[model samples]
Target: MYENYAQRLAVVYEATHKPEDFISADFEFKKMMRAGSCSAEDLRCYGILHHQMACYCIDKAVDLFDKVIGQGKAVDKDVFWRTKHQKMILYSQTGKAQKNIDEALAVINDGSEDAEDWICLIAAYSYSGDAAKAYEWILKAIPKFPDKAALYVYGGDTCRDLKKYDEAFKYWRKALELDDKMYDARYSMGFCYEELEEYGKAYDIWLDIARDLEEDGYEIEKQFPMELAEKCKAVLTDHPA
Candidate 1:
């Protein structure tokens, strides 16, 4: 049953990493679907593989997902939710973020589960530059995962994007409260402070990230800290205390 499927997939193996070969994964997935003996792992694999394809070929990926769903197999619940979320990602990738956000809102309204799903839903709205809707969904999702540092960090970034500096600061501070070692959150706080012209505060926060990165045995240049440190120095130089 899978003979033809496997053969066709082999044709595209060499093209996998080529930037010009868009839909390479989809080409492979088509073979898998044709196998007719898929298992739950196959369904999950199909979901993720198509999702990666959806990043480059939304329509084809969506079709692949539809095919996977039609296979009548029991997909893992997490994979199921992620696949559904990938539908929203497909809309976003196709420049229909608002439409996906509207649909996601409807889905949540109809009682969807999973904090991560809600995170992606809010991200869809945010990607479309709709900060208000993003904020709304994030606000709703936060309570469900109150201690999750990532949620606060995401919320803070959204607020920063909206220029809601105070709100951004509040969220970043909350994230630090939950996990003080989150260097990125500390860096983000610096960004918010910088935007607010609170250079002293920004410098202080950047220094904090720098110190933490050093302690982790990672070079400050290994990530974003070095640039941030330079920025802090520049700010202090221009506005000397």
Candidate 2:
């Protein structure tokens, strides 16, 4: 098990392309377990190693969790939760949407209020078509972590899905207030303005977003606000006054 640890650690640090990392890590993890040279202490070590390996492949992580649990080696509770959480992430990434929702809900049922747990719960709800509950959770999270811009973005998305445009605008603008450099907030506000039929205001805000993105070298001109700004320009051209 220790033999695979070095290679797995290297792949994890190079997080840019993940499929390659997962394959290598999974191979090494399985190789160690199959080699059967592990000591009694190797059980605990394997638990930690498997948990990290799961970051590359959730199925392999699940297998490792089973191995740990079966070993009865008395690993940490945090590691257990982390293993479960990684499995949920894998479920989500692999498009097993309901599985993600169910597993994340299981985490919350365990009475853990850590940021990872709540964020995963929120994501599961959003992905599983429960925008109302997702909004409720974000409301709770906002007071819990007032400085987190993700809560605001999630609130805005939930409100928009529910057709509460004004509330959506309020949340997006709140996100901007919390982090003026929030690129999505600027683009989302431009969208909210468009939905409210405030075309001139929308155009101006989108143009501002385009300029900000350009300054940041973000290639934003091909994305939301910039794209919309280009469309608005086309419309304005046909109706030039």
Model number with the top TM-score = 1
Global lDDT of each candidate? 0.71, 0.71
Q: Candidate 2's residue-wise lDDT over 1-241, tens digit each?
A: 3344735444473554455665565566567668875556555554655555555566656688776545442576557655655555566666787887777778788887676667778877876678998888887787887777767877887888889888998888888889997777777777777677666777898888777877888784637677788777776667553
Question: lDDT tens string, model 1, 1-241?
Answer: 3344433343343347343443554565665678766666556655765455545555557888777646533656556655766776666767788887777677677787757657777877877777887888788889888987877888998999988887897888899999989766887887777777777787777667767777788784435756766777797898797
What is candidate 2's CA lDDT for residue 54? 56
By summed lDDT, which 10 consecutive residues of candidate 1 come out lowest? Answer: 1-10
Segments of candidate 1 deviating more than 4 angstroms: 1-96, 99-110, 220-223
Per-candidate TM equals: 0.57, 0.56
